[model samples]
Target: MHDTEALQAKFFWFSPGDMTDVRQFFAPGRVNLIGEHIDYNGGHVFPAALTRGVSLWVRPRADGVVRFFSVDFPETIEARVDELEFRPSDGYANYTKGVIKAVQEEAGTLFCGGDFFYMSNLANGAGLSSSAAVEVVTAAAVRALMAYPLDNARIAVLSQRAENDFVGVNCGIMDQFAVAMGKAGHAIFLDCQTLAYEWVPVTLGDYALVITNTNERRGLADSKYNERRSECEAALRRIQEILPDIQNLTQISIDRWDDVETHLASEPNLLRRARHVVFEEHRTNEAVRVLKAGRLAAFGQLMNDSHVSLRDDYEVTGPALDALAEAAWSFSGCLGSRMTGAGFGGCTVSLVRRAAIPEFEEHVRVAYADKTGLQPSFYVSEIGDGVHEQQKEGLEV
Candidate 1:
C-alpha cells in the first residue's frame, strides 16, 4: 500500500496543469519458481508475481490521442487512438500500443484516449518479464479508463493477444496470466493448455528466493526462442505419425514415452526438446506435491534436476547462465539454482537460507564474474498481487 498524496507528487510529475482526474494502477513482473520453457508445450508452470513492477498514472484526454511518457525511457510516444501499429523505433511504447489495439479490437469501438505516465523498477532484459509487466499494466489502465466490464482474466488474455498479434511475439499465457492474477505469498500452478490454476502457498520460511541476472541482455524476439518452438512443433508432428490419436506432447504418459521415443530418436535436437517438455511437466507436478508437504530440500533438488534437463536436453542455457547456476550450487547455503526464462541469457532463480543470503551473494558475485567476466545483479524477491487499482481518493477513471 502507498500514500496517495505522496504518490501524486511523484507519479504526476510530467502531467499537464489542466489534467486533474488521475488514477494509479500497477502490474507486477513474475519469476518462474520451478517450471521453465514448458508453458507453450501444454505443460505446467509455477510462477509467482513479484513486488517489483510497473506503475501508471493516467487521465483521459478530450482529443482521442494517446500520449505516453515514461520516466524509465527518454523518448515520448504519441499517436492517434485509431492508428496504433507496430513501430520498431517506438521502443517500449510498442507494448503500450499493442495492448490498446487489442482492447479496442475486443470492444469493437474506440474508447477514450489518455495521457499515460509510467515508471518501473524491473530490469528490462533480465528474463523477469518486463515486457509482460508493461503489457499487463497498460491493459489494466486502459480497462479502467474505458470503464469496460472486463475481469482480470480477460485483461490477461488481452495482454497475451497484444503480445502475440500486435507485438509479434508468440508467447505463452503464463506471464500475462500470472501478472494479472497473482496473489501475495503464493505461486500459481497453471496448466498452460487447459488454463486450470491453483494458488499454491509459498512457505519458504527460512529459504529466500533470489534471482541473479547474467546481464547478457538477450531479447526473446531475436533469441532462439522461436527456433525452439519450431523444433518442438516438428517433433510433435513426427510423434503424431506413430500415434494418430495423440494431441500434444503433454498427452505422452511415462508408459507411452518409450513408444514415442523411438520415433523422435532420428532427430537428436527434436528428441531432446521433447524429452525436456515431458520430464519438466512431471517435475512441476512433483514440485507442487513437495511444496505442499513442506519438503523444501526435495523441492530444491527438483529445481536442480529441472536445470540439467534444460541445459542438456532443451539446450537453452548458455555459458553465462551456466556459470551463474554453477556458482550458486557451489555456495553452501544455496539449496538449488537454475537458469530461468528463454535462457540463452537471462537470470537464474536460487533458493537459499535467508541468513545465508549476504554471504551467498558475495560468493556468487565474485565466482560468476570470474567465470563470465560479466558482473551480475541480484534481487531478493517477494510475491505480490497482480494488476489492480490502487486504493485512493480519486474519480474512477
Candidate 2:
C-alpha cells in the first residue's frame, strides 16, 4: 500500500462510499539477466521475480459497469463488464485489456460489475517486465472474482496471449510466468520449450541485485525484438528442412553450428540474432551452476560476457548499456553488470557488494551521466512475493 498510495486518486474516481468487497491482487517483475531473445528459440531462460509488483483493490459492482483507474497512471479508464474495449495501440491500457480478454476467453466469467483500482511501483521499461506484472495480478483478481479457473500456468499463457495477439508485441511467456509464479529468494530456470522449470537458489553473499536505468530512448516492442524472434524461427525452419530432425534452436550442437551458420550467412542480422539465442542458452545453464557453487565473482564475469555478446553479436545493446557495464566492471566493488531488457537502451542489471552499494551507485551515476549526458535511475530490489490482499475499512453506498 505504500507504493499504491503513490499512484493517483483521480483515476479511481470512486469515493469511499462506493467501495464494496475487497479482493486479492498479484503481479511479477522479470530480470532478464541473460539469455535474451532465446525463449522464442526454444532456449532456456533464467529470470527472477524482483521485489516489485502491481496490486489491485477490487470489489463487487452492482451497476453492471466495471469502472477502473490506474493508481500508477494519472487517468481513469472505464468500460462496461459487458463492453470492455480494446485499445490495441496503447502499451499501458492494453495490459488491462489483456487480462480481461485472456480470462474471459478461457472461462468467460463476468465481473458482475466491480470498481477496480491498481498500483505498481515497478518502473516501466526498466527491463523489469512491469507490463507483465500488471497483466498477471489483474488477471488473478478477475479469476477469483468470477470463480473461474485458477491455474497459474494457464494464467501465464493467457497473459502472454494478451501481450501477443491483443497487444501485438509477440512476446515470450517468461515475464508473465515468472511473476505469476515466483518464490522469494530464488531464481527460476525455465525451459521455454517444455514449460519445465527448476528453482535455483540465489544466495548472493552480502550483495543484492541493482537495476539502473540507462534512459536510452528506445521503443521496446518496436525495438526489433520481434524481428529477432522471427529470425530465430526462420533459422529453426531452415535447420528443420535440412536435418528434418532439429525441432528447436536449443537442439543445435557446436558441431551442427557450422551447418546452422551456413544457412544464416545470407542474412547477417538474423545470423547475429541466432547467435545470441543459441549462445545465451548455454550461459544460462553455466550461470546456474556457478551460482550453485557459491562463486559470485565467477558468475559476475559470466554476466559481463553475456552482455558483450548481446552488444556485439546480438546487437541489442547500445553505447549507454555498454558504458554502464564497462564502468561497473572497472569498479572493485562491482561484481558484474549488463544491459537487462530489450536492449538498445532501457536498464542494466548489476550484481553489487552490500558494503559498496553507495559508492557503486555514486561511481556509476556520475560516470554514466558524464559519458552519455543522461541521468540514470537506480533501484535496489530483493526477491518479493507475487500478489496478496488485505481487508479494508471504508465508506459504502
Candidate 3:
C-alpha cells in the first residue's frame, strides 16, 4: 500500500495554496492487459488498473458551475452544472463533457457544482486509455463531491455512453469498466454481453507483465472499429432471422460455426468478423483454465495464436504490432506476447520473468527500434486498485 505521504506527493499538481477543508478526490485510468478490440463483439478482455492514473481533487461550489483544471494538460474548463455539452475543438472537454452528459442522462439530473484539479501521466494512444480514464475518474469524482449515490457499474455505463455519443467514438465498456472496477494482482475476465466478471488471479511469482509499444499509428482505428461492429450487427441480423433466440455472436456455440455457413457466405467480411468473436470467446474461457493451472507457457502460446487470429482473421493487427509480438516470442524470457488495444499501432503486452527484466527490456528495445526506426517505449506495471479517494484530513495517503 502507498503511504499517505507518497500518495500526496504524487498529487503535487493539486496545490492547496489558499483553499482549505476540501478533501474528496479520485484517480483512475484506462487499462489494457491482454484483450483488445474484443469487447464490442461481446468477447472477453483481461485488463488491470494502472498504478498511474488520473488524479482528481474536487470540492462542491455554491454556483452551478463545474470549473476544472488539469495538472497533466495544464488547462481550465468551466461548464454549467446542468448544461453539459461537447465542443468539437475542446480536446480536454471531450472527457469531462462525456462524463457529465452520461451521468446527467442516466441520473435524470445532477445535484451540485464543483471545481476539480485533474492530474494524469498516462500518454494517450499508447493503448493505455488515458481518455477513458479521465472520463471515468472525472465522472466518479463529480458524483462523490456532489453527494450523488451511483453504482460503479452505472458510472461505467454512463462513461461509455458519453464516449460513444459525446466524444463520437464507438468505444467498448472494457476500458472504463476496468479502470473503475479493477482489483489488485488479478486479471479481470469480463463477459461483455452479460457484464458479469471474475477476478482471475495472475500469480506470477517469478514473472511480470511487460508492455512494449509497436510505435505504429492507430490508423483506421475508429473506422475499422465501427466497421467490425457493423459487420457483427449484420451477422446478428442474418442469424437472428433464422434463429430468433440468438442474441449476439457471443451466444453462438463453437460447433454452430460450421452449421451456419451459407448465411455467413453471403457476406464474407461479416463472416470473418463473426468468426473471430465466436472463437475468441472460447479462447477467453480456456485462457482462464490455463491461467488457473499456472500454465503461463501455454497461456503465452495462446497469446501468440490470438495475435495471429487478430492479424490474419480479424484483420486489425498491423505490421508493427505483428513484429512486436513476433520479436517477444523470440525471447527466452517472454512467455507470450500479443498486440494490445485497437491495434493499428499500439503496445504489445507480454508475460516476462521478473529476473529477466533487464535482458528482456534491452533485447526488445534494440530489436524493435532497429527494425521499425521507431523507438519503442516500455512500461513495467502490476495490477493496481480501482477508484479510490484521497482526503485532505488523511494527507492523501
Index of the highest-lDDT prediction:
1
List pairs with backbone clashes in candidate 3: 4-397
lDDT (tens digit, per residue) of candidate 1 on 1-397? 3454655564456565543577778889999987788888888999999999888878788788998887667777999998998999998889899999999888887968888887778887888888888888888988888878888888888999888988888998999999999999999999988889999999999999999999996854345888988888888899989878877776677778888788877788888999888888889999999999999989989999999999999888988899999999998899998887888888899999999999999999999889989998898999999999886555222
Model 2 lDDT at residue 89: 38
lDDT of 2: 0.76
Candidate 3 weakest ten by summed lDDT: 10-19
lDDT of 3 at 276: 77
Candidate 3 per-residue lDDT, tens place, 20-91, comes to: 745554555545655556788777887777777776666667787777776545567778867777776667
Ten-residue stretch with the least lDDT total in model 1: 1-10
TM-score of each: 0.94, 0.91, 0.90
Overall lDDT per candidate, in order of appearance: 0.86, 0.76, 0.76
For model 3 the local lDDT of residue 134 reads 80
| Sort by lDDT, top down from the best | 1, 2, 3
Against the true structure, candidate 3 has what lDDT? 0.76
Error of 3 at 191 (Å): 1.5
